[model samples]
Every structure is written in C-alpha cells, then in structure tokens.
Target chain A: MRSRGAGTRTQLTKLEELLRELRVEEVMTRRLVSVSGDFTMAQVKELLRKHRISGVPVLEGEALVGVVSIEDVTRALEQGEMGAKVRDRMSREVITVFADEPAVEAVKRFAHTKVGRLPVLDRGGKVVGILTPGDPVGRAFRVMDLRYREQEQQRWQQKGLGLEDLLGEGASLVLRFRVQGEDFAGAGKASVQAKRVLGRLGLDPGAVRRATIAAYEAEMNLIIHTRGGELTLEATPHSVVVEAVDKGPGIVDVEQALQPGFSTAPEWVCEMGFGAGMGLNNIQSCADEFEIESEVGRGTRVRAVVHLSQSGRKDRLNR
Target chain B: MRLQDIKVQLEAEQVAGSPRPELEIKEACAADLMSDVLASARPGSLLLTGLTHPQAVRVAALASLAAVVFVQGKEPLRDTLVAAEESGLPLFVTQLSLFESCGRLYQAGLRG
Candidate 1:
C-alpha cells in the first residue's frame, strides 16, 4: 500500500508539471453558455437540456452572479418553484478560476470544492469561460501523448542516421530566421526557435546546446549592431552550422572585435546585461569551426559550426 | 538541490508559473546580463538575476534554465510575468540581495 501510494505521488507530480505548463484559457470552454439572472429556472432547465450541459453561469451584465446546475433545476421542478428567477434559485457563492491562472489551480479548486464547473474570469473580473474537471485531464493526456510521439520520432530518426550516409548524400536541413536590430524585447526569439528545431531533429544534446548558444550570440550581435539581418541554421547528420548575415554599419577591426571582453556597446546596452564583448568569443568557443568576415562599409557575416562527433568538447571558458 | 530547498534557502515567493518542488537544480548562475547567462549557464541550472525585464525570462527560456529568481525583492515587470507564463518558466522573487541569495544556496550545497 505504501509503495502504491508512492507511485501515485510520482504520477501526480508528473501530471502536475504538465498542468503547470497549461493555462485555464487553453483548457476551458470558451463558447460559454450563460443565462441572465432574470431568467426563470424553467428557462435555465430548457437551456441546459438544449446545450446538454450540467450547469450554466447566471450573469448580471458581464458579471457572473451565480451558477445554476442540473440539481438546482431538478429541485426547482420538485418544489414547484420552476417559475423562480435564476438569481434566487442559483448558488450565489460561485467558485471561479482566473483565465490566466495555471490550470492546476482549477484542478485544486475542483478537488476541494467538489464542483462540476468553475467559471473562468479574466483579470478584469469578467466571465470568459468555464472549466470542467475533464477539460484539464483531457488536455494533459493529449499533451502527454503528443510529447511521447515526438520523443519516439526523435529516437527513430536518430537511430536511422549514419555519418557515412549523411556525408555521402550531402543531404542537410536548413532553417532561416530574420532578426531586427535594437529589438531588445524580440531578441533571442530566433535562437530559441533554432534550439527547438535542433532538438526535434534528434541531434546530440551537447551539440544542440553548443549550436543554440552560438546561434543566440550571433542573433544578439545582429540585433545590437545592424539594422536587421538573417540567421541561417543548416544541419547535417554529422554537424550543425549557424550563420548570421547583416547589411551595413560593419565592424572596422574584426581582430579587435574578436578579443575577449572587448565591446563597443554603449552604456545603455551594458546596463541591460549585454555588449560585454562576449558575443563573438562565445560563438568562437562553441563552434568547432568558426569564421568571421566584414567589409567596413558592408555588414558582418559570422558562421559557427559544431561537429556532432565532437559533442564531448566543453565550453572552455564557461567550465 | 531540489527547487523546494532553494526556495526555502532564499525564502522565495513564486510570482509566475507553478512550483515543481521536486525539480532538481544542480547548478546556478547569477548575472544581470542575458548574454553572460547565455554564454555560461548550463541547461537546467537556475538563474539568479536582478533584472526583471521580459528579456531575462526569455534568456532563461532560451538557455533552458530551470527557473529564474529575481533578487532584492524586485517584482518582474508585467511583460516579464507574461513572458514567464508563456514560456512555462517558473519565476520567484526574494527579498534577499543577489549576493545573499547566492550565499544561502551555496551554503545549502547548490553549486554554481
């Protein structure tokens, strides 16, 4: 019994993690079927039967005033109070969940309150949707199934790849991203996308990490230095290549820029925890093969390649 | 150390995402610069920073950090919280300074 309890606990933890990744808005029913407070319980009974739902929220304008459930409808009919208004018959203490709150919160409320549904509200206290117990569970199961399939696909792909075959055929996968300069908020978006794509390709974990780091650095340089540029990631079975190309306001001295801790970034840039002069150095160290070329008036182009077989190599400076 | 232990060590208040107390945190990197965190922080390591910008959350997500702890009781900006929610990156705030937070975690046997 103790071991069984332990197993259940672990499973619950896993489920909880998945739930944390999801929001109430994602799992809740958005096509809300609601009736106004003035509607008769007889009317609510008809609405519930028409929608085949167990419950509906009673709204006063946009505000959720109460909940009228199937049980209430039955009681109203039995007590010969079918003509009573929903506002008087409905349960006023309606438990609610926030639309933006983690889905787990709704699960907790469901567990403790034993309610069939909870109206989901937005930050402004407006009813947006309703969450049923099955919604989160169904969503969690779907997400878990999807994740399992992805992992299986990654494993199958990884097993199918052979270095010789890849090199002989010269087949490669390519991904491209456009980076906008001075878009601090939008920075790192490309690298994150690249990292996910590489992971899905089933590359070596270390290789993926190195490639992601290099891609992020290159993406950053594009955002900080140029007006805009494009980042290209080309992947073969044996290697991952990251390239960043920008149009103008190029570097004057490529050698100086390559030096560690040498940054030409302004004070505002430094305060944001960037322009530490580590971008190029980071890319150089992560890549098994690194190259940089710039024409003073033209833009800079940096490329870094991480070999799959050399995934064991550590980031020298970082370690 | 588990995230629960680190939370206790720093007396952190989770501001975004749900807590995974069982989540293992083997290392941590403390830096305000997103670039530094990207260059050095290992995947699954915790990030300790004073920067509450959304970019900090983005950097943590991009770098695959386990979580982000904002030191000095600094609540993240609204956009940062939104980013955290979107990325599923757990965020915490501590009244402790960055130095003190790091010290507490180190004392609790969490390595950098």
Candidate 2:
C-alpha cells in the first residue's frame, strides 16, 4: 500500500484545503432576505413560500432581532395564532458567524449548533449577509474554477507566437517546462500547454491527443514520485515526442512500475483519484515508441513518441 | 443518442453548465479511478463516476470528455461543480447506482 516515494506531502484533502482558504464573507449570500418584526406570522409564511426558503432573519429597522422559521410558522398556525407578530414567535437567541471568519469555523458551528443557517456579522456587529450550509463550499468551487480558467487563458495568451508560422519543412521545435514536485495543484498544466501548442501546429488530432495524454501521465509521475523534474515536448511534421526527466528517489523496480494497478500511492492520494498504479502503463499505451531509464538512488527518465500517420502528415503538409 | 434523451432516461439533475439538447453522446465509460479514464476513454464520450472531487472534472477536461454524471445521488463538492462550469463541461447527478445507471444507458443504446 506504500509507493516507495509517494505521500510525502501534506495530507489535507482538497475540500479541507479549500475550507481553510475561503472566508465566510466570500461564500455568504449578500442578498438579504428579512421580514420586519411587525410582520404577522401569516405574512412570514407567505414570504418564505414565495422565496422558496425555510427561514429568514427578523429585523427591526436595520437591526437584526431574531429569526423565524417554517417550523415556527407551523406552530403558530396550529395554535390558531397566524396573526401573531413575528417578534413573538421568532427565536431570540441566534447563533451567528462572522464575515471574516474562516469557512471552516462556520462549518464547525453548523455541526455543533445543528442550525440550517447563521447570520453573518461584520466587525461592527452589523449583519452583512446570511451563511447557509451550501454557500461556502459552492462559492469556493466557483472561485477556484474561475482562477483555473483565467490562468489557462493567460498562459495561452502569453505564448502568442504562432508555432505554425515558425516551423518550415525539415524544422522541429522544442518546448520545455519545469514540473514542481508534490505540487498537485499545478499538475496537468504542462500537458494542457503542450496539447494547445500541438493543436495550433496543425498536428493530427489523434497524434496530439496521444502525446498530450502521455505528457500528462509523465508530468504526474514527476509530481508524485520525485523532488521535481522537466517536461519537454519536441514536435516535427511527422511525430511528437514527450520526455520527462526527474532527479532522485527513483523507482526500485521499473518493470513492476509499468504494470497497471501496481501503485505505491498512499491511501489519501488514492482517495483523491490518483496513485492508481496506472500512470506508466497509460503513458506507454499512448505512445508508438516508449522508453524508461532509472537508477534507484539517482533518477528516472521517460520518453514517449507518438508518430503521425501518413494521412496525418499529408494533412499537415497540405495545411 | 442526444444528451437530452440520456438525461431523461437517467432521470438526472443538471447541476452545472448550460444544457445542449442537441449534443450527441454515443459512448460512456464508468470509473472512479482517473487513470483508467485517461487510458481508455474516447474523446466526446460521457463519463460516469462516483468521484466528487474537482480532479474528476479536471480529468474529464483533460480527456476531452463531453460531460460527467455523478451516480448514486452523490453530490459533487461545490468546487467540483464550479470547475465543471468553468471548464464548460456539463455535469449531472443521478439517484441510481453506477450499475443501474450504466444498465439503463446501455439498454437505451449507449455503449461503453
């Protein structure tokens, strides 16, 4: 169950990492849903139904006074007091979260208090927003996704020189990138870059895909197994070559590592959907020519080549 | 089959990305391990998985998958949904187990 050199990084699951990084204010709903204290229970019930919400903060002017819920509304109706003021039926003691607090704190509060929502207060103790069970996680995902897309687009824009125009017949181009070890957050990036570059060069779609997949798996191996490494892509009109060279903590058994389901990745890494013992095999399968060289204490190097078929080469030349 | 018909057959909820009713999806591969996906899945195929982490969406994007469906009523983390939307990968959630979801899709003429 242990890969000789895997799981040496922090063990925080992705969700735990996100919760620590996100603040309550970033995730809370800023659109306030409130009912004045003077509103009758009958009116509160109608408001809840209209908004498709279970509860709302009760307010007196701009001051948060209490919270009224569907349960309270039901109780009022059962008691034949639908006309009772919200102030009388609302829960006076509220469990609140601060806008600046880590989202983890709000999650803990929810677990301990068993409440569906908490009013979010700013430093001045004024309610700024409402924190629901789903808000923090949902918001964190959105923010991270946006960041990922932006970074990818920025990389694409930065490499604006046209590879298509640069390479003539009998000329080849090389693109190199550094892969940081245990940097799971930045994994797969180099492959994406290579894929885009190959696509722009008008390589065959199948050849580009194979090279990209091989490069990705090799990039992942460098991140999971070594201190750090370099991913290099060399492309010509007829073939694409992907190479990964990493220093130290080399594989003890290169033959064993090539087998599917022979992963040495730890439990946590496996849970994250990696370390499945399939990276090497996957890389090998995608390449028309594959090579690996390793020295247990020195390093490991992998090279995979995907050749463009006759039709692919003709299509590239015609373009 | 069209993605819209597959959605109806699976009785799934579209959690992320806009629906393209006319989008065609002819193949699907079910897996929790991402490497298996990168190894075998064809481009434009649908991915059915129980893995709810953002990595699942990342792998789907890397492999050029047409969409992802989370089986067994498993809700993806908020980050996962956001990644799907940002990557322009459609996501769905179904109450059926993986076996049942695959069975229904297979019966409806979809292949792995």
Candidate 3:
C-alpha cells in the first residue's frame, strides 16, 4: 500500500537529495552527555546510570580532554577507585571525529574501533556532538526510505494514478485487531501486522524494530492483564503510531507498572517468560514518544510513536 | 571484539536466530538477573547469562542487545529459541561458567 498526503513526502525527497552530501554535523547528536573533568567518580556514575549510557566525554573548559566509560567505572569500583576524580580514571587520549567530516567516516571509525560513541568536534576542536554506532546507520536508512518513497511517488505519477488509488483511499494506513484476553496464541498478530506495514512503507529497520517491540509489548499487556482490547496501528510517511486500548480491570497504579520488574501478571504469564514488569518500561524506551493512561475501573490506553526521520531536526541548512 | 570472534574465543555454538558475526560487541554485561540486565545493559552490547528461558530472549530484544551468550553449557528451551528467532536476537551457548565467560570477555576488553 502507498499514499502521500502529509507533504512529508516532499520534505523526505529534499532530505534524500541532501543525503548524498551528508556530514556528521547534520546527523550527530548535538546535546552531548558530557561531564566535567573534576567530577567525582560517584557523580560520574550517577550521570551514566541516569542517562543509561555506556560512556561520556570529559570536558575541561571547552576542550575535549578524555572519556570515562562503563569499563572505567567498573574497574574503578572493583579496585576502590570510586572516590577519585573523573580525570584520574578517564582515558585521556581520546579519539574524536570532526563534525564536518562525512558520516561514512564516523561509521568506519565506529566499526573499526568498536567504540560505542565518539565525541564530535567542531573547527575549534570543541566537543559539539556525540556520534554513536547507530547514528550513521539510522541516517542512512532514513535516506533510503525517503529515496524509495520518492521513486514510488514518481512511478505512480507517471502511471497517472491518484494517491488514493495507490493506497486504497487513505493518507495513512490503519490496522485494527481485536486482542482477546489470555489469548497467548494471538498475542503477536497485531504487532506483526504493524511491522509488516512499516516495512512495506520502507521505514528504517531500527524504527520498525522499535515500533514493533513497543506494539508487541502493548499487545501482550492487554492480553495478559485486561479482559479484552483493541490494538490500532497507524502508519504515516514520517512516523508510525501504535495505540493499545483495553477494557478494564485497569491498572491500580500506572507508575508502578511502568517500573521494571514490577509485574501483576499471573503465574501463567510469568511461565510464558513475560510479566517481568519490563513491558511498559521497554515500550517507553523503544518509543520516541510514549504515553499511558489508566483509571481504576476504566480501561488503559497506551500510545507510542516511532519516527522514521533521523535526528528529528527539521532545519537542514542552518544546522 | 566481533561477535563471531567472541564466539570462537569462548568456543561457543550458535543455537538460534541470525548469526551476525560481523556485528561488533561494544560492551558486555554478564548476569542472570533480568532487573540488572534491564538497568545496566547498553544497546548493541553483548549479554552473557546463565538464564536459559524465554525471558532471556525477551530481555535481549527489549534491551536491543547485539547478542546473547549462554554460559555453563546451558541451552535455552524451544520457546526461548523461537523468541530469539522472532526478535532477531542472536543466541550462543558456551560450556564455560558465567564468571569464566565474563572474565574472558573482560580480558578481551568487554565491560562488566
């Protein structure tokens, strides 16, 4: 199925044309998770754990001085180095790539060094962004999706087919499936359908994976906890949204259920290897945007959106 | 280290899912506790555990782990294998104990 009505298709085509000239500055994460060199081990550990990141750059003034990673922290904790400063434990000889460099260069460095992230530097050699192993690939897939969509649009135009004619009269594809309570056999159907729709739309595989996982988790939650539910999958040119609406017995405590390892699921759900209480947490982590609302006797609603774009930065020229 | 190289270093065998030998193993977390894994596991890192259940695969999928290495020669059940396959999370089995497996990966520079 194919249709373009949101005008994101136009933006995507422009992105595709710009992709060939892509640079690290355009795709790198500008909001860097960096620490001061004078930060204590306790402080650094807290930062890393809070962000759920493996490593962080150490900055002394505007200069990129070092990197403190999980390995360094683990080694420090093991050897009673917990009280020392980050400068004392960080790898001083840091490897960095310039933001003006090509994205492929960053990919090669990540692949060769096996490093989880690299601090991106500006012309002044200051850390301006951080590039992870996934960033380049994410950008690449977004470019590919845009290119494919552009080509599909051109083909349809040449064939003189209207957008509705191509996608069965819709700006977005909506997939709805009824989820039966305790229906373990049918749990993943909605998720699978959502994934297929995303893939057919030529979204980035990582985005598809994340959306599929979130949808699967939400589907499982409805199947296990509620009496019955409806799973809705909505796919757009720029994003995919999945909403799981279930009939009561709504959650007594939504926040507690979002906590990892806090499950109210029965023994059978546990036996199936789910109900770890990680479902909601995982869904939130996987989604670019996530929300859950529940009332005691009313139903629960989970809505998650995974974007098909890279970096979520719409400004191409200024940045 | 690459996952295939890690497999070879540990003399492990691929039991289920896609064998992405070329995929890099940036960091690793060795644990049997799901809570710890969820709390500490970095995305694209390797997970070395003794837990051989479907939960293990589910955890790997949720955490976006690069791969799972089962220690102590244990094997995951059929349901776990199916989950791993469905999630596209690579699974490997090693005869070495959890401590030994972690030590080897650590010696080779796998964090934790």
Candidate 4:
C-alpha cells in the first residue's frame, strides 16, 4: 500500500507539472482540414460533413484568412446562399491562438470567445494546426495515463515490502472502532474517520473513494446483521486494509452474499435506504483483494484491501 | 460582457461580490434544478436560477461557474450569502422572471 500511495501521488504531481509545462503545439492537430477561399459554400458544407467537424479554417495559400463554422454554414443555407464562396460565408474577423502559447491559454480563449475551435498559427502567421476543446480534454487524459504508467514502472524497482511489513511498521496508522448492532447512528462513523485520515494522507482520490465505500458497507453489515463487531482500518503509504470481525449470525452462503441484490437485511433496514443486498457485492468490487470466512453458528470475518495505485479502472458508468 | 453590464441590463441587485463588477461573463445558463446545472452548465458560464440556497452556491463552486443570478426576485438565505462570499462567487438577484432574464442576456450576445 505504501508503494501504491507514493506511486499515485508522484504520478499526480507529474501530471500537474506536465500540464503547466505543456504548450498548444504539443496537442493541436497539425493535419488541418482547411478550405480555400474560392471553394463554394456547398463544397465547404460537404467537407465539414465528411470530416464530421463543426468548423474549419479558411486558407488563402499558406495563410489562414478566416474560419467557416457550422453556424455560418447554417445561416448561409437558410438564406439560399449555398452557392456563395467560402470567403463570403466565413468570419474574417477570427480569433486565433499561437501554437507556442501555453495550452492553458487556449482554455481561456475558448471560454472567453465562446468559439468551438481556433486556428493555431506558427511564428510566420501560417495556419499550422487547429485546436478545439476536445484537444485539451483528450491531452490531459493521455498525459496523465502515460505518467501513471511511468510511475508504476518506478514503483516496481522498490517493491521489497509486503503488505504486513508496511502495515506493521512504526509509521503505520491503525484505527479501531466498535460498531454496535442496531446502532444506525454510529454505522458510518468509522468509515467517515477513515476517509478523513486517508484524505489527510493525500491518497489518490479513487483509492480513497474505494476504501471508504468498502468500510461503510462492511460497517453497515456488522450493524444491521451481527450482534456486535470490531472494524479496524490500517493505512500505510501504499495501501489501505480493512478488517471486520463480528460475533455471530455468520453468513450461511458466502457465494450468495457476494452476489448482487443478495441481502439478509430486514424490511426496516431497507426502509432506511440500505440493505438493497449490495453491501457484500459492493465491498468485493471496491476492494482490490477481498476475502470472507464464516462459521454458520459462530462468527464471520471479512478482509478487504484497496491499493492506492493508478491501475484502477474508472468504469463507474457501466455499473 | 461584464457582471456590471448584466446587472444593469437585468436590473439585478448585487447580493455579494458587488465590488468585483468587472468580472467577465461569456455565456449564461438558466435552470432551477441544481442537478441540471451540475450536469449541463459549462465552467465560466453564468448561472441564472431562482433557487437561493447553500447548495446552489456549492454547485456553482463545484462547476466553476462565473456567477449566480437569482431570478424572479428571489433572495438567498444569510448562510447561503455567507457561503458565496467565502467561496468568492458573485451573486445577484433580479426582479425579472427566468424567461425575461435569459432573453435579455441572449439579446446582449450571451450564449447558452
């Protein structure tokens, strides 16, 4: 967990550093789909449709003179001016961004001008590339991902410590809470504390979120089902480990409990906006590694581990 | 346009951040529901809504909106105003209805 947390933090720092250092020329599309001034409005409209773009720069020789957008084309078509030349339909008073400018400057231009795209110009005032809002969004994601992988490689070099070695060290943080059965008020207290501690540690947001979700669901399960239980959270620089041990009413079918919509919770618990049978399933999904052991008559113990690394996939939409 | 321009055009009362009237506003979005604004409103766009609560201010900060305008003569609670001041988000209250406020902004060259 220590390596994972450190690795994620280093990657995030790198991303911010890269964003500050990046310039528009690093991400702007160089192969521009520009139209000449002599092109007819119908041909320009066809060009936009073929490229599936909202706008394009109008170039005379190597110099960009104006930009024709979907809005401009729509206005021309509405007025039965499809046969007009591109120069007439295009906005000559165009706002452009220099390729050497910081990428952040383009963001400001997009916001202030309310323009969908900007023609990127070189030092010679030549239209070298085109920039759109999608360029920045895509570039940020790509750079972050690449940096994450690079940090992961570095982590692999210093991977001697096991989970126990990191969690049992003098620098380890362990938090324990007694979760009383039927104590709805105190059910999520431990999870909230864990979230705060992890936040203070500056763990990756995705890891912190997963750890909190796992802790809360496990805590709720202890409160709503068991007699009483102890929830323990151990956080190191690289990982968060949660252990929940209860007294009795152990699960009879661990596989069934792991399935979605499988709950032993009562009606009142359901009415309280919980016990949708997703607790165990959610815990399993949130944790990188999950384990459960139960003796039908005696007790149950569940352990979950969330690695504070950038390898976690962000596919919340599919779920 | 600037916040001061919007204030004059819509006849809005400055609830907070009145001294920073030179703040630039490029686009405007009108929605009463906070969820809609969160999902649809772009960063730096002006938010025009009648809901004056702490959550509205929170949503504006989270979305990085330029400012919040309370339409239909709506006024925010004291706590909400305090939250706005703390967040450094400008707030205004206009007597005009949502439709009238949006129409005036559109006529003034503000996009959706």
- Point out where model 3 deviates above 4 Å: A1-170, A183-193, A255-262, A267-276, A310-319, B31-43, B58-64, B82-89
**Candidate 2 runs further than 4 Å off:** A1-166, A313-319
Q: Estimate each model's TM-score.
A: 0.66, 0.62, 0.51, 0.38
**C-alpha DockQ for predicted model 2:** 0.33
lDDT of 2 by residue, B5-89 (tens): 9889999867765345679998999999889999889888999999988878878877878899999999788888767766667
List model 3 lDDT by residue over A1-319, tens digit each: 2455546787655555554467776567654789997898888889999988889999988888899999999998999888999988999877788988877788778878888789999898878888888877675555455556547734543554332343664487788889999887556667765665555454555666677777888888888898889998777656779899987989898878877679888997776556778878878887889998999898999999977655322212100
List candidate 4 stretches off by more than 4 Å. Answer: A1-171, A310-319, B1-112
lDDT by residue (tens digit), candidate 1, A1-319: 9999998898778788989988887677656899998999889989999989999998889988999999999999999999999888999998999988999999999999999999999999999888889988776765565566557746745575443354456778888998999888888878877777666555665777788889988988988888999999988867889999999789999999999899998787788888899999999978999999999778899999988754322222232
Model 2 sits at an interface RMSD, in angstroms, of: 6.2
TM-score of 1: 0.66
Clashing pairs in 3: none
Better DockQ candidate (1, 3): 1
In the range A40-74, model 4's lDDT, one tens digit per residue, is 88998899999899999998999888999999889
- Model 2 B-chain TM: 0.98
TM-score of the candidate numbered 3?
Answer: 0.51
Q: Which structure among the candidates has the greatest DockQ?
A: 1
The best candidate by lDDT is 1
Write the residue-wise lDDT of candidate 3 on B6-94 in tens digits.
Answer: 98889886766653578888788887765467556766779998878776777676556789988998867878777775655778889
Candidate 3 Cα deviation (angstroms), residue A276: 4.2
Alpha carbon lDDT at A241, candidate 1: 93
